[model samples]
Target: MQLPWMSRTDRRHWKSARTTAALGELMAQWLEGSISSRPGYTPRYGPEDETRPLVPTLAALCRAGYVTTCSQPGLVGWGADDAWWEQRAAVEGVVTDPVLLHRLVDAATTAGLLVRTIDYSRNAPGEAPIPVTTRNCETAGEFGGRISEADMAAQWRGLNPDLHDEVSHGTYVIILAPEYGPTGNRLWRILAGSVQEVGHAA
Candidate 1:
Protein backbone atom coordinates (compact mmCIF):
# COMPACT_ATOMS: atom_id res chain seq x y z
CA MET A 1 0.00 0.00 0.00
CA GLN A 2 1.28 3.42 -0.94
CA LEU A 3 1.20 6.18 1.60
CA PRO A 4 -0.68 9.28 0.49
CA TRP A 5 2.52 11.30 0.84
CA MET A 6 4.58 8.74 -1.04
CA SER A 7 2.97 9.04 -4.44
CA ARG A 8 5.49 8.85 -7.26
CA THR A 9 3.96 11.87 -8.96
CA ASP A 10 4.24 14.01 -5.88
CA ARG A 11 6.93 16.60 -6.61
CA ARG A 12 7.14 17.61 -2.97
CA HIS A 13 7.97 14.10 -1.85
CA TRP A 14 10.56 13.76 -4.57
CA LYS A 15 12.22 17.00 -3.61
CA SER A 16 12.28 16.04 0.05
CA ALA A 17 13.85 12.68 -0.71
CA ARG A 18 16.50 14.29 -2.88
CA THR A 19 17.32 16.90 -0.31
CA THR A 20 17.66 14.27 2.37
CA ALA A 21 19.98 12.20 0.24
CA ALA A 22 22.14 15.18 -0.59
CA LEU A 23 22.43 16.14 3.05
CA GLY A 24 23.35 12.58 3.95
CA GLU A 25 26.01 12.45 1.27
CA LEU A 26 27.43 15.79 2.30
CA MET A 27 27.57 14.77 5.93
CA ALA A 28 29.21 11.51 5.02
CA GLN A 29 31.88 13.23 2.99
CA TRP A 30 32.52 15.69 5.75
CA LEU A 31 32.95 12.95 8.33
CA GLU A 32 35.18 10.97 6.00
CA GLY A 33 37.43 13.96 5.21
CA SER A 34 36.49 13.91 1.54
CA ILE A 35 35.69 17.42 2.66
CA SER A 36 37.91 19.17 5.17
CA SER A 37 37.57 21.77 7.91
CA ARG A 38 40.81 23.69 7.45
CA PRO A 39 40.65 27.47 7.17
CA GLY A 40 41.71 27.37 3.51
CA TYR A 41 39.55 24.39 2.66
CA THR A 42 36.81 24.80 0.17
CA PRO A 43 34.26 22.06 -0.25
CA ARG A 44 33.43 20.70 -3.66
CA TYR A 45 30.63 23.25 -3.91
CA GLY A 46 32.33 26.22 -2.30
CA PRO A 47 33.83 27.60 0.88
CA GLU A 48 31.66 26.63 3.84
CA ASP A 49 32.11 26.15 7.55
CA GLU A 50 31.87 22.56 8.75
CA THR A 51 31.62 23.06 12.50
CA ARG A 52 27.81 22.84 12.47
CA PRO A 53 26.38 19.66 13.97
CA LEU A 54 24.96 17.13 11.53
CA VAL A 55 22.49 15.47 13.92
CA PRO A 56 19.46 17.24 12.55
CA THR A 57 20.42 16.43 8.99
CA LEU A 58 21.01 12.85 10.00
CA ALA A 59 17.58 12.75 11.56
CA ALA A 60 16.08 14.00 8.35
CA LEU A 61 17.99 11.37 6.43
CA CYS A 62 16.71 8.69 8.78
CA ARG A 63 13.16 9.78 8.23
CA ALA A 64 13.68 9.70 4.49
CA GLY A 65 15.04 6.12 4.61
CA TYR A 66 18.46 7.14 3.40
CA VAL A 67 20.13 6.63 6.76
CA THR A 68 19.77 4.81 10.06
CA THR A 69 21.22 5.10 13.53
CA CYS A 70 23.86 2.50 14.41
CA SER A 71 25.07 1.55 17.87
CA GLN A 72 28.50 0.47 16.65
CA PRO A 73 30.92 3.23 17.57
CA GLY A 74 32.77 2.91 14.27
CA LEU A 75 29.52 3.24 12.38
CA VAL A 76 28.06 6.13 14.31
CA GLY A 77 29.13 8.70 11.77
CA TRP A 78 26.86 10.43 9.27
CA GLY A 79 27.08 8.04 6.33
CA ALA A 80 27.64 4.79 8.12
CA ASP A 81 25.34 2.34 6.33
CA ASP A 82 24.37 0.68 3.11
CA ALA A 83 21.42 2.93 2.45
CA TRP A 84 23.54 6.05 2.33
CA TRP A 85 26.31 4.33 0.39
CA GLU A 86 23.90 2.89 -2.14
CA GLN A 87 22.31 6.24 -2.75
CA ARG A 88 25.73 7.88 -3.06
CA ALA A 89 26.96 5.11 -5.34
CA ALA A 90 24.02 5.50 -7.66
CA VAL A 91 24.69 9.21 -7.99
CA GLU A 92 28.45 8.75 -8.42
CA GLY A 93 27.91 5.96 -10.94
CA VAL A 94 25.97 8.28 -13.18
CA VAL A 95 28.01 11.43 -12.77
CA THR A 96 31.69 10.36 -12.64
CA ASP A 97 31.80 8.74 -16.05
CA PRO A 98 30.99 10.71 -19.17
CA VAL A 99 29.54 7.80 -21.10
CA LEU A 100 27.45 6.50 -18.22
CA LEU A 101 26.37 10.01 -17.34
CA HIS A 102 25.07 10.52 -20.87
CA ARG A 103 23.21 7.23 -20.74
CA LEU A 104 21.68 8.18 -17.41
CA VAL A 105 20.67 11.55 -18.77
CA ASP A 106 19.10 9.85 -21.79
CA ALA A 107 17.17 7.50 -19.52
CA ALA A 108 15.97 10.36 -17.34
CA THR A 109 14.89 12.33 -20.37
CA THR A 110 13.00 9.35 -21.76
CA ALA A 111 11.35 8.74 -18.41
CA GLY A 112 10.31 12.40 -18.14
CA LEU A 113 12.39 12.62 -14.97
CA LEU A 114 13.65 15.93 -16.22
CA VAL A 115 13.00 18.51 -18.91
CA ARG A 116 15.47 18.36 -21.85
CA THR A 117 16.05 20.89 -24.57
CA ILE A 118 17.81 20.02 -27.85
CA ASP A 119 19.29 22.41 -30.38
CA TYR A 120 20.10 21.33 -33.96
CA SER A 121 21.33 22.85 -37.20
CA ARG A 122 22.67 22.12 -40.68
CA ASN A 123 26.16 22.77 -42.08
CA ALA A 124 27.01 25.74 -44.29
CA PRO A 125 26.85 25.71 -48.14
CA GLY A 126 29.60 23.17 -48.78
CA GLU A 127 29.99 20.73 -45.92
CA ALA A 128 28.17 18.13 -43.93
CA PRO A 129 27.47 19.41 -40.45
CA ILE A 130 30.83 19.40 -38.68
CA PRO A 131 30.21 16.35 -36.56
CA VAL A 132 32.98 17.29 -34.13
CA THR A 133 31.84 20.82 -33.45
CA THR A 134 28.20 19.83 -33.53
CA ARG A 135 28.79 17.25 -30.84
CA ASN A 136 30.91 19.70 -28.86
CA CYS A 137 28.13 22.23 -28.97
CA GLU A 138 25.85 19.59 -27.54
CA THR A 139 27.97 19.71 -24.41
CA ALA A 140 29.24 23.29 -24.66
CA GLY A 141 30.66 25.67 -27.23
CA GLU A 142 34.31 25.06 -26.49
CA PHE A 143 35.40 24.96 -30.11
CA GLY A 144 33.71 28.22 -31.02
CA GLY A 145 34.15 29.08 -34.70
CA ARG A 146 34.34 25.45 -35.75
CA ILE A 147 30.55 25.23 -35.70
CA SER A 148 28.75 26.63 -38.70
CA GLU A 149 25.88 29.10 -38.42
CA ALA A 150 23.40 26.66 -39.87
CA ASP A 151 24.52 23.87 -37.56
CA MET A 152 24.33 26.19 -34.58
CA ALA A 153 20.86 27.35 -35.58
CA ALA A 154 19.76 23.76 -36.19
CA GLN A 155 21.12 22.70 -32.83
CA TRP A 156 19.33 25.58 -31.14
CA ARG A 157 16.09 24.48 -32.82
CA GLY A 158 16.60 20.86 -31.84
CA LEU A 159 17.11 21.89 -28.24
CA ASN A 160 14.26 24.37 -28.25
CA PRO A 161 11.44 23.72 -30.72
CA ASP A 162 10.32 27.27 -30.33
CA LEU A 163 13.50 28.22 -32.19
CA HIS A 164 12.65 26.00 -35.13
CA ASP A 165 10.48 28.70 -36.65
CA GLU A 166 13.36 31.13 -36.21
CA VAL A 167 15.86 29.02 -38.08
CA SER A 168 15.35 27.83 -41.67
CA HIS A 169 18.32 25.46 -41.90
CA GLY A 170 20.17 22.93 -44.09
CA THR A 171 20.77 19.93 -41.84
CA TYR A 172 19.48 18.70 -38.52
CA VAL A 173 21.67 19.37 -35.49
CA ILE A 174 20.73 18.69 -31.91
CA ILE A 175 22.18 19.37 -28.46
CA LEU A 176 20.37 18.11 -25.40
CA ALA A 177 20.42 20.51 -22.49
CA PRO A 178 19.13 19.11 -19.24
CA GLU A 179 18.71 21.02 -15.99
CA TYR A 180 20.19 18.49 -13.60
CA GLY A 181 22.82 18.67 -10.86
CA PRO A 182 26.51 19.26 -11.54
CA THR A 183 27.75 19.08 -7.95
CA GLY A 184 28.19 15.79 -6.13
CA ASN A 185 25.62 16.75 -3.52
CA ARG A 186 23.18 17.89 -6.16
CA LEU A 187 23.85 14.70 -8.11
CA TRP A 188 22.95 12.66 -5.05
CA ARG A 189 19.74 14.61 -4.80
CA ILE A 190 18.90 13.72 -8.39
CA LEU A 191 19.66 10.06 -7.73
CA ALA A 192 17.48 10.10 -4.65
CA GLY A 193 14.70 11.65 -6.67
CA SER A 194 15.06 8.89 -9.24
CA VAL A 195 14.98 6.20 -6.57
CA GLN A 196 11.96 7.68 -4.81
CA GLU A 197 10.15 8.06 -8.09
CA VAL A 198 10.79 4.45 -9.02
CA GLY A 199 9.89 3.09 -5.61
CA HIS A 200 6.69 5.07 -5.43
CA ALA A 201 5.76 4.07 -8.97
CA ALA A 202 6.22 0.44 -8.03
Candidate 2:
Protein backbone atom coordinates (compact mmCIF):
# COMPACT_ATOMS: atom_id res chain seq x y z
CA MET A 1 0.00 0.00 0.00
CA GLN A 2 1.62 3.21 -1.15
CA LEU A 3 0.61 5.59 1.56
CA PRO A 4 0.25 9.30 0.84
CA TRP A 5 3.65 9.93 2.43
CA MET A 6 5.94 7.77 0.28
CA SER A 7 7.88 9.37 -2.54
CA ARG A 8 6.82 8.61 -6.11
CA THR A 9 10.40 8.21 -7.38
CA ASP A 10 11.95 6.04 -4.69
CA ARG A 11 14.80 3.83 -5.88
CA ARG A 12 15.40 0.23 -4.86
CA HIS A 13 18.65 1.04 -3.04
CA TRP A 14 17.50 4.30 -1.51
CA LYS A 15 17.92 3.10 2.07
CA SER A 16 16.94 6.21 3.99
CA ALA A 17 13.53 6.50 2.40
CA ARG A 18 12.89 2.79 2.28
CA THR A 19 13.84 2.47 5.92
CA THR A 20 11.66 5.39 6.92
CA ALA A 21 8.54 4.10 5.22
CA ALA A 22 8.92 0.60 6.54
CA LEU A 23 9.50 2.03 9.98
CA GLY A 24 6.41 4.19 9.66
CA GLU A 25 4.25 1.16 9.10
CA LEU A 26 5.72 -0.33 12.23
CA MET A 27 5.02 2.90 14.06
CA ALA A 28 1.38 2.78 13.02
CA GLN A 29 1.23 -0.75 14.26
CA TRP A 30 2.94 0.37 17.44
CA LEU A 31 0.40 3.15 17.93
CA GLU A 32 -2.53 0.81 17.48
CA GLY A 33 -1.18 -1.30 20.36
CA SER A 34 0.14 -4.00 18.09
CA ILE A 35 2.71 -4.37 20.88
CA SER A 36 5.14 -6.54 18.94
CA SER A 37 7.47 -3.71 18.01
CA ARG A 38 10.62 -5.41 19.19
CA PRO A 39 14.05 -4.51 17.84
CA GLY A 40 14.03 -7.04 14.99
CA TYR A 41 10.37 -6.44 14.35
CA THR A 42 10.25 -7.40 10.70
CA PRO A 43 6.82 -8.98 10.59
CA ARG A 44 5.47 -6.41 8.17
CA TYR A 45 6.52 -3.69 5.69
CA GLY A 46 3.16 -3.07 4.00
CA PRO A 47 2.67 -3.59 0.24
CA GLU A 48 5.33 -1.30 -1.22
CA ASP A 49 8.38 -2.47 0.69
CA GLU A 50 10.87 -5.12 -0.36
CA THR A 51 10.65 -8.41 1.49
CA ARG A 52 13.33 -7.57 4.05
CA PRO A 53 13.29 -7.44 7.85
CA LEU A 54 13.39 -4.06 9.60
CA VAL A 55 14.42 -3.02 13.10
CA PRO A 56 11.39 -1.13 14.35
CA THR A 57 13.34 0.78 16.98
CA LEU A 58 14.73 2.98 14.22
CA ALA A 59 11.25 4.46 13.78
CA ALA A 60 11.91 6.48 16.91
CA LEU A 61 15.05 7.90 15.37
CA CYS A 62 13.50 8.69 11.97
CA ARG A 63 11.89 11.85 13.24
CA ALA A 64 13.36 15.38 13.35
CA GLY A 65 13.20 15.60 17.16
CA TYR A 66 13.98 13.25 20.04
CA VAL A 67 11.45 10.41 20.31
CA THR A 68 8.96 10.48 23.15
CA THR A 69 6.58 7.63 22.38
CA CYS A 70 8.66 4.75 23.59
CA SER A 71 7.06 2.75 26.38
CA GLN A 72 10.50 2.09 27.75
CA PRO A 73 12.04 4.74 29.94
CA GLY A 74 15.50 5.03 28.38
CA LEU A 75 16.81 5.96 24.96
CA VAL A 76 17.15 3.10 22.47
CA GLY A 77 20.66 4.33 21.76
CA TRP A 78 21.84 3.46 25.26
CA GLY A 79 19.55 0.54 26.05
CA ALA A 80 19.38 -1.79 23.06
CA ASP A 81 21.10 -5.16 23.32
CA ASP A 82 23.51 -6.99 21.02
CA ALA A 83 20.54 -8.62 19.30
CA TRP A 84 19.67 -5.15 18.03
CA TRP A 85 22.98 -5.14 16.17
CA GLU A 86 22.11 -8.32 14.30
CA GLN A 87 18.64 -7.01 13.51
CA ARG A 88 20.11 -3.79 12.16
CA ALA A 89 22.70 -5.68 10.14
CA ALA A 90 19.97 -7.71 8.49
CA VAL A 91 18.25 -4.55 7.31
CA GLU A 92 21.11 -2.24 6.29
CA GLY A 93 24.13 -2.72 3.99
CA VAL A 94 27.32 -4.19 5.39
CA VAL A 95 31.11 -4.02 5.49
CA THR A 96 33.33 -4.95 2.57
CA ASP A 97 36.26 -5.96 4.82
CA PRO A 98 36.51 -7.19 8.42
CA VAL A 99 40.19 -6.94 9.40
CA LEU A 100 40.71 -3.40 8.19
CA LEU A 101 37.30 -2.63 9.63
CA HIS A 102 38.46 -3.71 13.08
CA ARG A 103 41.55 -1.56 12.78
CA LEU A 104 39.24 1.37 12.24
CA VAL A 105 37.15 0.06 15.14
CA ASP A 106 40.19 0.37 17.42
CA ALA A 107 40.74 3.87 16.06
CA ALA A 108 37.35 5.30 17.16
CA THR A 109 37.01 3.42 20.44
CA THR A 110 36.57 6.62 22.46
CA ALA A 111 33.02 7.67 21.48
CA GLY A 112 32.08 4.26 20.03
CA LEU A 113 31.86 4.36 16.22
CA LEU A 114 32.79 2.25 13.14
CA VAL A 115 33.29 3.18 9.51
CA ARG A 116 31.95 1.54 6.36
CA THR A 117 35.29 1.06 4.60
CA ILE A 118 38.78 -0.32 5.16
CA ASP A 119 39.68 3.14 3.91
CA TYR A 120 37.98 4.70 6.98
CA SER A 121 41.19 4.19 8.98
CA ARG A 122 42.42 7.63 7.97
CA ASN A 123 40.01 9.77 10.07
CA ALA A 124 39.05 10.56 13.68
CA PRO A 125 35.99 10.18 15.94
CA GLY A 126 34.76 13.56 17.15
CA GLU A 127 33.72 14.75 20.62
CA ALA A 128 30.59 13.01 21.90
CA PRO A 129 29.78 10.20 24.29
CA ILE A 130 26.88 9.10 22.14
CA PRO A 131 26.88 8.08 18.46
CA VAL A 132 27.26 11.37 16.59
CA THR A 133 29.26 13.00 13.74
CA THR A 134 30.69 12.38 10.30
CA ARG A 135 33.78 14.55 10.72
CA ASN A 136 35.80 11.49 9.67
CA CYS A 137 33.51 9.21 7.62
CA GLU A 138 34.71 7.22 4.66
CA THR A 139 36.00 9.31 1.75
CA ALA A 140 33.23 7.81 -0.33
CA GLY A 141 29.90 7.55 1.52
CA GLU A 142 27.78 5.08 3.44
CA PHE A 143 25.06 5.04 0.77
CA GLY A 144 27.31 3.27 -1.71
CA GLY A 145 28.92 6.54 -2.68
CA ARG A 146 32.36 5.17 -1.73
CA ILE A 147 32.46 3.36 1.62
CA SER A 148 30.17 0.55 2.81
CA GLU A 149 27.78 0.02 5.79
CA ALA A 150 28.69 -3.21 7.62
CA ASP A 151 31.95 -1.67 8.81
CA MET A 152 30.02 0.83 10.91
CA ALA A 153 27.57 -1.82 12.17
CA ALA A 154 30.31 -3.83 13.83
CA GLN A 155 31.07 -1.69 16.85
CA TRP A 156 28.46 -2.86 19.39
CA ARG A 157 28.83 -6.38 18.14
CA GLY A 158 32.36 -6.02 19.59
CA LEU A 159 35.43 -8.29 19.30
CA ASN A 160 34.25 -11.15 21.52
CA PRO A 161 31.97 -13.08 19.23
CA ASP A 162 31.20 -15.46 22.07
CA LEU A 163 29.39 -12.70 23.91
CA HIS A 164 27.78 -10.57 21.23
CA ASP A 165 26.46 -13.41 19.00
CA GLU A 166 26.55 -10.91 16.17
CA VAL A 167 30.09 -9.78 16.87
CA SER A 168 30.46 -9.45 13.13
CA HIS A 169 28.48 -6.19 13.22
CA GLY A 170 30.80 -4.47 15.78
CA THR A 171 29.99 -1.38 17.86
CA TYR A 172 29.73 1.96 15.93
CA VAL A 173 28.77 3.91 12.77
CA ILE A 174 31.05 5.77 10.24
CA ILE A 175 32.02 9.41 9.37
CA LEU A 176 31.91 12.77 7.54
CA ALA A 177 31.51 14.18 4.00
CA PRO A 178 34.46 12.93 2.00
CA GLU A 179 35.63 13.54 -1.58
CA TYR A 180 34.00 10.43 -2.97
CA GLY A 181 30.32 11.31 -3.17
CA PRO A 182 27.30 13.45 -3.97
CA THR A 183 26.54 13.27 -0.24
CA GLY A 184 28.09 11.64 2.82
CA ASN A 185 25.81 9.24 4.72
CA ARG A 186 26.11 8.60 8.43
CA LEU A 187 25.32 5.34 10.27
CA TRP A 188 24.96 5.30 14.03
CA ARG A 189 25.19 2.05 16.06
CA ILE A 190 23.64 3.30 19.26
CA LEU A 191 23.30 -0.17 20.77
CA ALA A 192 24.69 -2.12 23.75
CA GLY A 193 23.98 0.59 26.32
CA SER A 194 27.22 2.36 25.47
CA VAL A 195 30.85 1.17 26.03
CA GLN A 196 30.99 1.69 29.78
CA GLU A 197 27.90 -0.44 30.36
CA VAL A 198 29.44 -3.13 28.22
CA GLY A 199 32.62 -3.07 30.32
CA HIS A 200 30.87 -3.16 33.66
CA ALA A 201 28.36 -5.78 32.57
CA ALA A 202 31.30 -8.16 32.05
Candidate 3:
Protein backbone atom coordinates (compact mmCIF):
# COMPACT_ATOMS: atom_id res chain seq x y z
CA MET A 1 0.00 0.00 0.00
CA GLN A 2 1.14 3.51 -0.64
CA LEU A 3 1.85 5.09 2.73
CA PRO A 4 0.27 8.43 3.29
CA TRP A 5 2.62 11.36 3.21
CA MET A 6 3.09 12.60 6.76
CA SER A 7 3.14 16.34 7.03
CA ARG A 8 5.89 18.08 8.96
CA THR A 9 3.47 19.20 11.65
CA ASP A 10 2.18 15.64 12.02
CA ARG A 11 5.60 14.13 12.71
CA ARG A 12 5.46 15.20 16.33
CA HIS A 13 3.81 11.83 17.00
CA TRP A 14 7.17 10.09 16.69
CA LYS A 15 8.74 12.08 19.50
CA SER A 16 6.30 11.05 22.15
CA ALA A 17 7.32 8.31 24.58
CA ARG A 18 4.20 6.26 23.87
CA THR A 19 4.59 6.49 20.09
CA THR A 20 8.23 5.52 20.21
CA ALA A 21 7.31 2.50 22.28
CA ALA A 22 4.52 1.58 19.91
CA LEU A 23 6.77 1.89 16.86
CA GLY A 24 9.39 -0.27 18.48
CA GLU A 25 6.75 -2.88 19.16
CA LEU A 26 5.47 -2.59 15.61
CA MET A 27 8.94 -3.07 14.21
CA ALA A 28 9.35 -6.31 16.09
CA GLN A 29 6.06 -7.58 14.73
CA TRP A 30 6.76 -6.39 11.19
CA LEU A 31 9.94 -8.42 11.12
CA GLU A 32 7.95 -11.49 12.13
CA GLY A 33 5.22 -10.86 9.51
CA SER A 34 2.76 -10.41 12.36
CA ILE A 35 2.22 -6.70 12.26
CA SER A 36 -1.03 -5.36 13.72
CA SER A 37 -2.44 -1.92 14.32
CA ARG A 38 -4.10 -0.04 17.11
CA PRO A 39 -7.13 2.19 16.65
CA GLY A 40 -6.25 5.19 14.47
CA TYR A 41 -2.59 4.23 14.29
CA THR A 42 -0.90 2.09 11.71
CA PRO A 43 2.58 1.30 10.49
CA ARG A 44 3.59 1.70 6.87
CA TYR A 45 5.80 -0.22 4.51
CA GLY A 46 6.84 0.51 0.97
CA PRO A 47 4.36 0.12 -1.91
CA GLU A 48 2.54 -3.17 -1.57
CA ASP A 49 2.15 -3.43 -5.35
CA GLU A 50 5.88 -3.15 -5.82
CA THR A 51 8.10 -6.13 -5.24
CA ARG A 52 10.03 -5.61 -2.04
CA PRO A 53 13.66 -6.03 -2.91
CA LEU A 54 15.89 -8.09 -0.68
CA VAL A 55 18.40 -5.95 1.13
CA PRO A 56 20.50 -6.04 4.29
CA THR A 57 18.23 -5.57 7.28
CA LEU A 58 18.93 -3.16 10.11
CA ALA A 59 19.38 -6.07 12.51
CA ALA A 60 22.16 -7.44 10.36
CA LEU A 61 23.69 -4.02 10.07
CA CYS A 62 23.73 -3.57 13.84
CA ARG A 63 24.90 -7.14 14.34
CA ALA A 64 27.94 -6.16 12.33
CA GLY A 65 28.10 -2.94 14.39
CA TYR A 66 27.68 -0.84 11.28
CA VAL A 67 25.82 2.02 12.88
CA THR A 68 24.83 5.15 11.01
CA THR A 69 24.16 8.43 12.73
CA CYS A 70 20.57 8.07 11.51
CA SER A 71 17.79 7.16 13.92
CA GLN A 72 14.07 6.43 14.15
CA PRO A 73 11.52 9.12 13.39
CA GLY A 74 14.13 9.89 10.74
CA LEU A 75 12.39 12.40 8.53
CA VAL A 76 13.55 14.02 5.32
CA GLY A 77 15.15 17.00 7.04
CA TRP A 78 16.54 17.36 10.60
CA GLY A 79 19.48 15.04 9.97
CA ALA A 80 22.44 15.91 12.24
CA ASP A 81 20.29 18.17 14.39
CA ASP A 82 20.84 17.76 18.13
CA ALA A 83 17.69 15.77 18.87
CA TRP A 84 18.02 13.23 16.07
CA TRP A 85 21.75 12.83 16.74
CA GLU A 86 21.22 12.32 20.46
CA GLN A 87 18.64 9.62 19.72
CA ARG A 88 21.07 7.85 17.36
CA ALA A 89 23.94 7.98 19.84
CA ALA A 90 21.85 7.00 22.82
CA VAL A 91 19.62 4.31 21.37
CA GLU A 92 21.56 2.86 18.42
CA GLY A 93 25.03 3.28 19.91
CA VAL A 94 26.08 5.43 16.99
CA VAL A 95 29.40 7.18 17.50
CA THR A 96 28.81 10.94 17.60
CA ASP A 97 31.87 12.63 19.07
CA PRO A 98 34.36 13.98 16.59
CA VAL A 99 37.07 12.97 19.03
CA LEU A 100 36.03 9.38 18.48
CA LEU A 101 35.38 9.74 14.74
CA HIS A 102 38.56 7.89 13.90
CA ARG A 103 37.40 4.92 15.95
CA LEU A 104 34.13 4.84 14.01
CA VAL A 105 36.04 5.19 10.74
CA ASP A 106 38.28 2.29 11.74
CA ALA A 107 35.24 0.26 12.71
CA ALA A 108 33.56 0.96 9.36
CA THR A 109 36.71 -0.01 7.50
CA THR A 110 36.98 -3.19 9.53
CA ALA A 111 33.35 -3.96 8.74
CA GLY A 112 34.32 -3.57 5.05
CA LEU A 113 32.20 -0.48 4.49
CA LEU A 114 33.43 1.96 1.84
CA VAL A 115 35.06 4.92 3.55
CA ARG A 116 36.98 8.06 2.57
CA THR A 117 38.60 10.76 4.64
CA ILE A 118 39.23 14.38 3.75
CA ASP A 119 41.28 16.43 6.14
CA TYR A 120 40.18 19.89 5.11
CA SER A 121 42.58 21.28 7.66
CA ARG A 122 45.57 20.03 5.71
CA ASN A 123 44.17 20.46 2.22
CA ALA A 124 44.32 23.42 -0.12
CA PRO A 125 41.21 25.58 -0.49
CA GLY A 126 38.92 24.44 -3.26
CA GLU A 127 36.26 26.64 -4.88
CA ALA A 128 34.48 26.38 -1.57
CA PRO A 129 35.67 25.39 1.87
CA ILE A 130 33.68 22.49 3.23
CA PRO A 131 30.65 23.79 5.09
CA VAL A 132 31.53 22.80 8.64
CA THR A 133 31.42 24.88 11.78
CA THR A 134 31.95 24.83 15.53
CA ARG A 135 30.78 27.15 18.29
CA ASN A 136 34.26 27.55 19.76
CA CYS A 137 36.43 29.74 17.55
CA GLU A 138 35.51 33.42 17.89
CA THR A 139 37.83 35.37 15.59
CA ALA A 140 39.52 35.44 12.22
CA GLY A 141 42.86 34.57 13.81
CA GLU A 142 41.49 31.32 15.16
CA PHE A 143 39.84 30.50 11.81
CA GLY A 144 43.11 31.33 10.01
CA GLY A 145 45.01 28.89 12.19
CA ARG A 146 42.83 26.00 11.03
CA ILE A 147 42.50 27.06 7.34
CA SER A 148 44.13 29.60 5.06
CA GLU A 149 42.73 33.14 4.94
CA ALA A 150 41.77 32.60 1.31
CA ASP A 151 39.68 29.58 2.24
CA MET A 152 38.19 31.52 5.11
CA ALA A 153 37.11 34.11 2.56
CA ALA A 154 35.53 31.28 0.58
CA GLN A 155 33.40 30.45 3.62
CA TRP A 156 32.02 33.96 3.55
CA ARG A 157 28.90 34.34 1.43
CA GLY A 158 25.68 36.32 0.90
CA LEU A 159 25.27 40.08 1.02
CA ASN A 160 26.87 40.09 4.44
CA PRO A 161 30.47 38.80 4.25
CA ASP A 162 30.14 37.98 7.92
CA LEU A 163 27.07 35.82 7.42
CA HIS A 164 28.90 33.00 9.15
CA ASP A 165 30.45 35.21 11.80
CA GLU A 166 28.75 33.41 14.61
CA VAL A 167 30.45 30.15 13.66
CA SER A 168 33.84 29.82 15.32
CA HIS A 169 36.99 28.71 13.54
CA GLY A 170 37.79 25.01 13.29
CA THR A 171 39.30 22.64 10.78
CA TYR A 172 36.80 20.14 9.43
CA VAL A 173 37.42 16.44 9.57
CA ILE A 174 35.03 14.88 7.04
CA ILE A 175 34.39 11.20 6.55
CA LEU A 176 32.21 10.24 3.64
CA ALA A 177 30.36 6.93 3.69
CA PRO A 178 29.28 6.75 0.07
CA GLU A 179 26.53 4.53 -1.23
CA TYR A 180 27.24 0.82 -1.01
CA GLY A 181 25.23 -2.11 -2.28
CA PRO A 182 24.14 -3.67 0.97
CA THR A 183 22.86 -0.73 2.99
CA GLY A 184 20.68 0.40 0.09
CA ASN A 185 19.49 3.85 1.08
CA ARG A 186 21.83 4.69 3.90
CA LEU A 187 24.65 7.17 3.27
CA TRP A 188 26.67 8.53 6.16
CA ARG A 189 28.69 11.62 6.91
CA ILE A 190 31.08 12.43 9.70
CA LEU A 191 31.41 16.19 9.72
CA ALA A 192 33.82 17.84 12.08
CA GLY A 193 33.94 14.46 13.74
CA SER A 194 30.19 14.30 14.43
CA VAL A 195 28.30 11.45 12.78
CA GLN A 196 25.19 12.23 10.73
CA GLU A 197 23.51 11.12 7.53
CA VAL A 198 24.79 12.65 4.31
CA GLY A 199 21.12 13.18 3.56
CA HIS A 200 21.28 16.16 5.88
CA ALA A 201 22.50 18.11 2.88
CA ALA A 202 19.42 16.99 0.95
Best by TM-score, which number?
3
> 13-127 in candidate 1: lDDT tens per residue?
2223223234335334444444332111222232223212333333333333332211011111123232211111111010222332354455556544322222223333432
TM-score of each: 0.19, 0.20, 0.24
What does each candidate score in C-alpha RMSD?
A: 21.0, 18.4, 17.6
lDDT of 2 by residue, 44-139 (tens): 323113111222333332221111121111111211332211011211222323433343345444433333332333444433322221223312
**What is the model-wide C-alpha lDDT for candidate 3?**
0.29
Candidate 2: which stretches are off by over 4 Å? 1-54, 64-111, 116-202
Candidates in order have lDDT scores of 0.28, 0.27, 0.29
Residue pairs of candidate 3 with colliding backbone atoms: 1-48, 98-193
Rank the models by lDDT, top first: 3, 1, 2
Q: Could you give me the TM-score of model 2 versus the true structure?
A: 0.20
Candidate 1 global CA lDDT score? 0.28
